[model samples]
Structures are given as structure tokens and as C-alpha cells.
Target chain A: MIECNNLTFSYRKATPILKEFNLTLENGGIYGLLGKNGAGKSTLLYLMCGLLTPAAGEVLVNGVNVRRRLPSTLRDIFLVPEEFDLPSITLEDYCRINAPFYPDFSMEALKRNLETFEMPEKIHLGYLSMGQKKKAYMCFALACNTPILIMDEPTNGLDITSKVQFRRFLAAQMNENRIILISTHQVHDVELLLDHIVIVDNRQLLLNRKTSEITSRLRFFNTLGAPDTDDPRLLYSARGVGGFANIARREDPLDEETDLNLESLYELCCRNPKLVENIFNPDNTSEHEQLG
Target chain B: MNNLDNFDKFSFSRFMMLAKREIISSKNIFLMELAVVAGLIIIAEFFISWSALPSLNDVKEYPSCYYSDSTCVSIIFVLGIWGFAFLANIAASLVCLKLSNKKGRITTFMTVGTQGEKYLLNFLIYDVFFVLYFFTVWLLVDLVRVIYVDMVYPFEGKWVLFYAIDQWNWMVALGTIALFLFSQAFYTLVSAFSPKLAFLKAFGLSYAVGFLLIPYSFFCSVVLIDKSFSGESNVIVIMASSVMIIYAIAMQLLAYYRYKETDII
Candidate 1:
């Protein structure tokens, strides 16, 4: 299990990035960390990876402090950053050096993953293209088989075919021993794979819910005309091709058949910051519990 | 299981891998070594040639062949060039140390087995390579001198040749050891910090030290060389060189011990 208790982090003293953040993630589930460009998504990921030091509170992975950088702790966690430079060496040579770090590392699996990603085995890492290098690193990380894997925009540079292949690979690879957290702006690509959705805005966790519960409770309905503007739960009303009334089902629904489009829900959540904060506040755990 | 700490499993090979990476990836180091070696050879040749120029008082004397001058020039040239091998070894140690620093101690601590021990071992290995290279250069120079000179100077005093070889050999050996030991300390200091900034930091500090100490210490030895050639043996100069070497080794070990307990950033 990964736990963050009252985690307050900032690059500088005054500019607070993450404030009094508390989050818990169990093993096996795929978590999608969604936020805007400067909403601290990457910073949160880096904090979890132990890449950046936390100002207050602690990030404990299976009772081990990440700050210590213990080998066992590191062996259990793998952070795939968006921008990383692999050392200039052949795939074989790179594997020979890094593979031994993780006890569960499988050379055979790494080789197979490389083939799956359509990366050549013999070429030096420096010779590989940017997309290919990312794939190679991803392949190696997957084969490392760490229990906690944090990937920052894993699908950023992937081609159409590779992206599809990557999704399939991820689905096939995921297991109960692993907890994967992916931070990305491309929600559609990861929406199907993620078991849970987490949104960050206004320096706090605005929403954190299981996909099944969220989809069931929140109905995203389209209307030809604008609904009563005074409705307290009317989170957002986007004027689409028809009219305004892009409603988020925060309270009891009028009818049962309507389904919530996650993209539309995300859009609604971002537009009105107060509604999201009010709905998912720590004080109202009972509401979230009811959804569970 | 009892023998192994958590780090032991990964630390050994990771450091070795990084060391190999450092050596192979850096071409600038080799170029620097070559440049220094070549420069030393040229400088030594110039000085030897200048010293051999005949004075006005020896105008009527039997013309001595410039063969002795050539021998002296060649010996000094070889010695100067060979000195760079030791300096190059120092360069390798510094590079490895710097690279380790930039990568961060976490990399060494988590991935490599025995971070401290592996650091020391890799540095020593780098030092050994340069030391052996210096020895090889010396042997090659000796071979060329013996083979090329015998045909020209048909019969010369073997004692003179032996004396010249003995005097130069100690200087070469001492120079090699002194630099190697100095590099060990430098590597520790650099590795204690991160390799990325470590080079600049090490260079900056060393340069500072050189500016402060070189004029007084380095020049003092140069002055002693002249005095020794007069009537005095210059025992103080020999003692100072010996003391400098011992101090270098002690300083390196002290740095290594300090690094062992300190928190790595």
C-alpha cells in the first residue's frame, strides 16, 4: 500500500504546489492522476517517485521511507518520467547493468517486451529514436516487475500502432502485486484501463472515486435547451451544438437511463471549482463511502 | 543471506558498470592526456637543448659530439611524457568520481553493491591502468635508446648509463605513485558530492589551492634542484617530496571515512 498523510510540498517557501494532501492507493488498481499543466500532477508523481524531496509529511511504500532511498524500497518502486535520458549503450549492455537492481527482474521478459514494442535488440540506446527509447525504457520498467509503478505521461510520444500495442501490453501485464499510477492529459487513452479516477485542482484532491461508482452516480446528460439556471447541483452548462444543460448528476437523478461521459464530467469539474471541492471534501467521507 | 546487506546485491555491479561507462563515454579525457604528454615532451626538449649550447670559453676544445646532448634530451623528453600517464590516471579517477556524483548517491546506494568499497575499487583499477601504461612507455623508451644509441657510440662507460637510468627511475616511480595517491583523495571528495557539479567544484578548489600553494611549494623545490647540484645534497627537498606523498594518501583516506557516515544528496 502507498500512503501520503498531510503531505505539503513546495518548490519555494511561498509558492505552495501541494497543500495538506492526503491520498491512499491500494495495490492492483490502475489510478489515473488528472490535472492541468501546472496543477502539480508531475510534481506529485515526482514526490511519489522520491525524485524530489517532500517538505512535510512522508511517503511510505510498504512501511519504508522513500527519502532514505533504500535498495529494497527502490526495488519495489519504478518511476517512468516523461523526459529521461538512457545511458549510451547497447540494449544488452544496459540490461546487464540495470537488471540486477530489481530482484524480480526477468531478462527473458525484457527481451520479449522489446520485441513487443518493435525496438531492435542490438542497437545502442543513443541510436534509437525518441519514441523507441521511451518504449525501450517502458519495456525495461515493466520487466522490472516492481509493485509500485509511477509513469508520467507514458503514452506521450507513442505512435498510433504503438499506443494501441502499449495499452494491450499494459492490460496483459497488470496484476494484483502491482499498483500503477499514470498521470496524463490524454484521458481517453487511459480511461478504459484505469479502475479509478483522481482529479487535482485548486491545490487539493477535488475528486477521487472508483470508476464504477462514479459512472453509476454521475449521469452526464445532453439537453436541447438550458435547464433551470438556479439549480444548486448544476455544476456546469456547456453550450454544445444543441444548447446548454451539460448536467453532472450530483444529486438524485430525474430519470435512470442517462450515462455519464467521463470527458464531459471532467470538463464540468474543471469549470466550477467549488462544486468539485464541496462534493469530494474530506469532511464528507460519508458521501464517498455511500458510493462505495 | 547473512553475509549480504540489502545493498550488497546491487552495489558492486552497478558501480562497476558506471565505472565502465565513465571510461568508455569520455573521449575528452584521452585527448587531454595526449595533449599534456606531448606538451611535456616538447618543453623538456627545449630546456635540454638550451642547456647543451656551448659557452664562449670552450671554443678551442676538442669538439664533443652532440650524442650526449641527444641522450639527455631523449631521456628528459621520455620522462616528461611518461609523467602524463600518471596525470591521466588522476584524470580517470576524477572523471569517475565526478560522474558518480552527478548521477547521485541514491543511484550508487540503491543499485550498486558496496557503494563506498566499489568506489574505491573502481578508482584503484583506473589508477592501475595508467600506472601500467607509464611503465610500458618507460620500457619502450629504454628499448629505443639502447638499440638506437649502441650503433653510434661504439664503446661508452656502462657505469654512466646505469647511473643515469637509476637517477631517472626513482623520479619516474615517485611521480607515478604521488599522482596516483593524490587522485584517490580527489575521487573521494568528488564522489562525496555529485559527479555533475563535482568536476567544477574539484577543479575550482584545486585551482584555488594551486594558486595559493604552487608559487611557494613548487618553486621552492625548483630552487632546491640548483642548490643540490652545487655542494649540498638537498635532503630537505627529498624529505618534503616524501612528506607531500604521505600527506596526500592520509588526506584521501580521511575524506573516504568522512563520506562513509555523511548523508548523500
Candidate 2:
């Protein structure tokens, strides 16, 4: 479990990125972290992985303060940053040099992940293209089999086919003991794989709900025009490529069930944060129920 | 379940692992250093031989005495030693720069071990390994030079290596080692604090210090001390060396703190 307790952080000469931000992640799910460009999603991931020390409060991984960066804590957690440098060495040599640091590193998993990504097993990481390098590094990261894995923009440099493969590979790698936190703006790429969704905006966590809970609480669909409904008020509505209107509304028991489209949900949450928060929070229903 | 509380913060095995990782990652750097030193040695040998040979007319300046002069051998040997030392400093600084300059590299390094282990690994690589490697390279160059001279133009003279060994004093050797440690430590601090352009920063700082030392020494000798000049010089050398060692220790401490608190964002 990773927990951020009242964490506050800010870069020098900049406004606070994360202020009194609190979060907790437990094992057994892939969390999709969503936010605007500068909404502190990446900063939260860095803090959780102990890459950046919080200005206030603390981040604890499995009951141990991440700031301490104990060897065992480091061994069990891996942070795949958006940008990384690989040495000018063959993948085999890279693994040989680095794999030993993590006692649970699995060569079999590496081979499997490489095969899944269609990457050559014996290529020099430095010589590969950016996309291929990302795939290879991701393979190595998953092979480490660390309990906590945090990836920032993992699918950024990937090609369309590689992105599909990456999703499949991530699904294959997930287990009950592992917690994967991915922070990215590319929500569609990881929509199906996400077990939980976390949305932060302006240093505040607007939503931290499981996919099931989100789907149960809200409904997403497209229609020719805005549907007339009073029980489930329209939280967000936007025009689509066709003459269709993409819409998200608070779920009601009497209404028919609809699959949750992550993109539309993200848009809805960003567009109507108060309504979304009220819909999710039972105690804060006083003001928002009027919209419903 | 992995218990982090049981993890050793400063494990010798982990230190060795980090050291091995560094060696593997820096293979190209080591090869480059070897090539540079070898090229320098070859060039120096060519120039020395060219200078020693008579100029077309059978009129040698010192005849056979040039090769046999202990003073000449000592000066050449000392130059070689200092040249290697200079190269070692460059190599050490470059290593530090490479390790700390890149965000990806620093993150990767920090992930592998505790801060203490990371700091120790830097010390081992820049301070210990580079110095030892310099001597090894020097020995190899000397052996090749000896063989080449013996085979090409046999000289009945004392070998430069033996001459250097004969001239070596323990106190001077200790002083040189202390100076080397101080320089390496200072560079390490500069690298840790400012990864990008570490070499430039260290070089600039060194130049600034060198520029100030002349005036400071002059002031100390002329105004500060009214006693004998030689006595004051001895006192200054001793005091400077002691202060350098102490400063080096302080730099290392600061480096450790920097490493521990580094947040690669």
C-alpha cells in the first residue's frame, strides 16, 4: 500500500502543485491517474515513488516512509518516468547489470514481455528507436515484479500497434499483489485496463473512484440531441464527429445501464466538478441534487 | 512479503553491485581514457626519441650521456606521473558528470541503492578506482616503452621507472595522494550539487582559486610573515596541505548530504 498523507509540494518560484494532497493506493489494481496538463498528476506519482520529497507531510509505502528510500523499499518499487536514459549497452547486459538489484526480477517475464512487444531480445537499448526503447524498458520494469509500479506517460512514445500490445502486456502482468499507477493524458489507451480512476485538478483530488463505482454512479451515452431527463440531470454534453451528442448523466436506479466512457467521464468531471463530486459523495448531496 | 525494515542500508554486497554496474555502464569511458593515455605516451615517446637522435650530422648534443642522466630521467618520469595524475582528474570529473548530469541516469542510480551506498560508490569510482587505474596504465605504458627502446635503440642507462622509484619519498607520495583526494572530492561535490555543466563549474572554480592563490601567497609571504621566507614557505605548504585534506572531508560530507536530499524531478 502507498499512502500520501497531507502531502504538499511546489517547485521553486512556482505556485504550489500539490497542497495538502492526501491519497492511498492499495495492492491489486491498475489505477489510471487523470488530470490537466499542469494538474500535478506527475508530481503526485513522483512523490509516491519517493523521487520527489514532499514539502510537507509524508509519503509512506507499505508503512515505511518513502523519503528514507530504504533499499528494500526501493527494491520493491519501480518508477518508469516519462523520459529516461538507457546506457549504450545491449539489453542483455543492461538486464545483467540491473536485474540483480531487485531480488524478484524475472528473466522469464522479461522474455515474455519482449515477445509480446515484438522487440528483439538481443538489441542494444541505445540503438533502438524511442518507441522501441520505451517498450524494452517497460518490459524490464515489469520483469522486476516489484510490488508497486508507477509509470508516467508510458504510452506517449508508443506506436498504435505497440500501444495495443502495451495494454495487453500490462493486463497480463497485473496480479493481486501488484499495484500499478499510471499518470497520463492519454486516457483512451488505458481505459479498459484501469481498475480505478483518480482525477486531480488544481492540487485537489476531485475523484478517486473505482471503475465499477464510477459506472454505477454515472451513465455515458450518445444521442441525436440532448435527452430530456429530470431524475438524471445532464452533467456534461458535447458534440461528436457525427450528428451525435456525447452525454454523461448521474446514474439512477430506474434508468437503463450504460457503459462508462472514460474520456466522456473525464470531460464531465472536468466540466462539472462540483456536480460530479456531489454525485459521488452521498453526504454532499444537498446542493447538487437539485441538478439531478 | 518483502520486509523493508530488515533491509541493510549500507550493505557491502550492494556497494559491490553498484560498483560493478558503474564499471559496465562506463566501459566506453574507460576505453576512451586508455586510448587517450596511450596516445599521449606514444606521442611523448616519439618526441623524446626524435629529440635524442643526432640531427643528420653525426653530432649528438650529449652523446650517450643524455639517456644516462638521472636528473633527465627524473624530470621525464615526474612529468609522466603528473600527466597521468592530470588525466586521472579529468577522468574522475567526467565520471561524476556523467553519473549526475542526466535525470534518467541519476534516477536509475538512486533507485538501485540507498543514498549512502550511492555516495560511497561515487567515492570508490572517482577517488579510488581512477587513481589505481592511472597507476596500472602508467605501468603498462612504461613496460611498452622499455621494450620498444630496448629493441629499437638499446641504451646503457638507468630505466625511468627505477629512477622515479629511487627519487620517490614517502612524505611527498603521501602529500600527492592527499592532494589527489582533495581534488577528486571537490569535483565530486561540484558534480553532486550541479550535475549539468559539472566539469565547467569545477574547472571555473579551480581557475578562480588558482588565480586568487598567487596574490594570497604573496600577501602572506611579504606582509603576514616578517620572519625568514623559507620558514614561512614551509609553514604555508604544511598548513595548505592540512587545510586541503580537511576541506576535502568537508566536501565529501556535503556531497553525501546532497545525494541524500536530491530529488530528481
Name the candidate that leads on lDDT. 2
Candidate 1 residue-wise lDDT, B116-232, digit = tens: 554565554445655565545544444454444443443321222343454454443454355445544564456454444554566567667783135233432443222223223
Top DockQ model? 2
Predicted candidate 2 versus true structure: per-residue lDDT over B22-75, tens digit per residue: 889878976786677767876775576556544434444434645445555554
Query: Residue by residue across A1-292, what tens digits does model 2's lDDT show?
Result: 9998878788886887877777889899999999898888877877787778888889998888887777877887898888888888999999999999888899999999999998878999778898888899999999999999999999999999999999999999999999999999998899999999998875567788899888776777788765665534666667777644455555467777667688888877777777777778868654321100
Total clashing pairs for each candidate? 11, 0
Candidate 1 structure lDDT? 0.62
TM-score of candidate 2 relative to the true fold? 0.88
How accurate locally, in lDDT, is each candidate? 0.62, 0.74
Q: Candidate 1, what DockQ?
A: 0.21
- The segments of candidate 2 whose C-alpha lies over 4 angstroms from its true place after superposition are A229-232, A243-256, A284-292, B1-6, B52-61, B98-102, B147-155, B211-239
Model 1 residue runs over 4 Å out of place are A12-14, A221-234, A239-247, A250-265, A271-274, A277-292, B1-125, B128-265
* Cα-based TM-score, every candidate: 0.72, 0.88
Indicate the docking level reached by candidate 2: medium
